[model samples]
Target: MYVRTVYATGDPAKIDESLDALRVEAPKLLADQPGYRGYSLFADREIGKIMMGSWWESEQAQRNSDDHLKERRAALLAPFAHTVTVDSWEAVVFTPSLQVQAGAGFRLSRFDVDPSDVDLLVQTFKNTVLPKVQAIAGFEGMALLIDPAKGRGSVGAFFTDRAALVASRGAQSAARGEATAKARVTMRSIEEFEVVLVERV
Candidate 1:
């Protein structure tokens, strides 16, 4: 599947309001679109970072979504967000898959990959990282998203809760390190978030 992630940042105090729209309104607006598959929302209330990933059956469908609800999206987010950004990626790896649970924990790791080595990097993720991540006690699922043209990619791990997310740090780090070295990709940022909602159809 192809995914489009909307990133919004603004008033930390209004974070909940922004998330509420995505959890409720945004999905409704997207449901009727062609090739729509699902939506997953994540947030870091402390920093007022809100990210919602919408899944589509193809790259074209994903691209279509960006224009499908432009007006409504702006209206819904403008009150709380000062800046909103969008990104699209092809899902290279989705293992076991991300489960939908309001309070689940999602840990996201960003990377700057070698454009020419996209396939090698994906294999490294599936082979070098997936096994270690799956071994974590609270692991639920994992996904790897890549933008070959931009040399950017990110991987996310879903956990049962905060404790599980915290406990799995060591192993996750080791696996990420190996993948980074082997794939010749630069690891960027890593942060954990609370899953607000996930709606699939």
Candidate 2:
């Protein structure tokens, strides 16, 4: 599977309106597209930051989607978003045990890795980090997306509520350190966001 993430920021007051367009109308545009699997939206209301991720069956399908929705995509965000950035990656680990809801707690951790250790990083997550993370209280699910060529990856950790997410911060950091140490990767940033909307097709 593949994941394409779009990051955007603009007026904080326009956050709600931007989310509506991205979650409601954007899915309509993607629903019928080949290889489309799901869509998830995250937002940091304080900063007016939005992160949108869409799942596809393959890299080709993910890339081709840009050609199909280029103009429509731009127009959709024009009213509310001031700047946007996009990234593509392979879904190395995606297992959602719980269906996310509006306001669900989400934490995104990004890392920069040595391209040569990409495979090792994947293995370390599966063999070590996955089990440790699954044991965290209120952990609903987790997914690791990576771009081997760029040697960048991100982990999306989902929790049942804000309290659970807060309580697990220490554990999350420890696990992150362990994974990066073993994989020879460096942590970039880790931040929390609220899940605004989710759609599975």
Candidate 3:
């Protein structure tokens, strides 16, 4: 699978409005696109930050949507966001216990691995970290994305709600730390967000 992520910073007050717009617009724009699989939007109202992601069946399919999505993105982002960052990645691992929906909590963790150890890192994640994460209370799903050429990867873990998220943090952190060290990866950053919208095609 291929994934595209858009990060933006905007007016906190307008965040809900922006998400509502996306909730209405994404399906109309993406539902019939070739190889379109799903899409989701997350936000951190207090920080005025939002992340929008679209999933595709393949790299070519993802690339094919870029031109069509460009204008839509501009229109939605222009009024609210002052800073925007966009990235694409290959989905390495995805485990969804339930369909993604509003009210879910997400924790995004980024890592930098040695280019030569990319496969090892991925294997370690699947063999070790993932099982532990799945066993956590309220665990809902997880997605791991990587750019092998750049040795960069990100993990997105979801929970049923904020309470579940908080309850699992300590165990999640410990497992992730061990996995990263074993894989010779460097932990970069982590961010939290609330899922506002999701659609699977």
Candidate 4:
């Protein structure tokens, strides 16, 4: 799968309005696009930050919808968002559970690994970390995306709600820390967000 991510920061007061607009408009605009799979909108209300991600069947499908996506983003988010960062990635590991949906909480972690350790990192995550994560209470789903050549990657873990998310933090942190050391990957940033919108096509 190919994924496109947009990160933005804006007025805290306007976040709800922006999300409301997105909830109404995004599906209609992207529903019929070729190879479109799913989309999610995440937000950190206190921090006034938002992250929107759309999944596609391939790079070509994402490229095909680029223009329309850009226009829609401008209409719904540009007015409120002061800064926006966009990126694309190929999904290396995707494990979805029935518990994942709107109202879930998400924890996103970015990593910088040595290029030579990319495969080991991916394998270790699947064989060790993922199993432990899935066993956690309220665990919903997870996805790992990477650009192996650049030694860059990100992991998104979904939980049932805020409480479940908070409860699992320590376990998650320890697992990630071990994985980081084992894979020789540098842990970058970790952020928490509410899953405001999630659509699977």
- Between the candidate structures 3 and 4, which one is better when assessed by TM-score? 3
Let me know the TM-score candidate 1 reaches against the reference structure: 0.95
lDDT of 1 by residue, 22-45 (tens): 788888889989999888999888
Clashes of each: 0, 0, 0, 0
Listed per candidate, the RMSD to the true structure in angstroms reads: 1.2, 1.3, 1.2, 1.3
Error of 2 at 45 (Å): 0.6
Compared with the true structure, all predictions reach lDDT values of: 0.87, 0.87, 0.87, 0.88
Better of 3 and 4 by lDDT: 4
**For model 2, what is the error of residue 109's alpha carbon versus the real structure, in angstroms, after optimal superposition?**
0.8
Residue pairs in collision within model 3: none
User: 1-201 in candidate 3: lDDT tens per residue?
Assistant: 899999999999877777777778876788768999889889999989989889999999998897788789878877678788989999988974348679889999998989888888888889999999999999989988999989898999999998898898998998898788887799999999998877766
Write down the TM-score for model 3: 0.96
How far residue 180's Cα lies from its native spot in candidate 3, in Å, is: 1.0
| Candidate 4 lDDT, 148-196, residue by residue in tens | 7788889999999999999999999988987998888998999999999
* lDDT value, residue 127 of candidate 4: 93
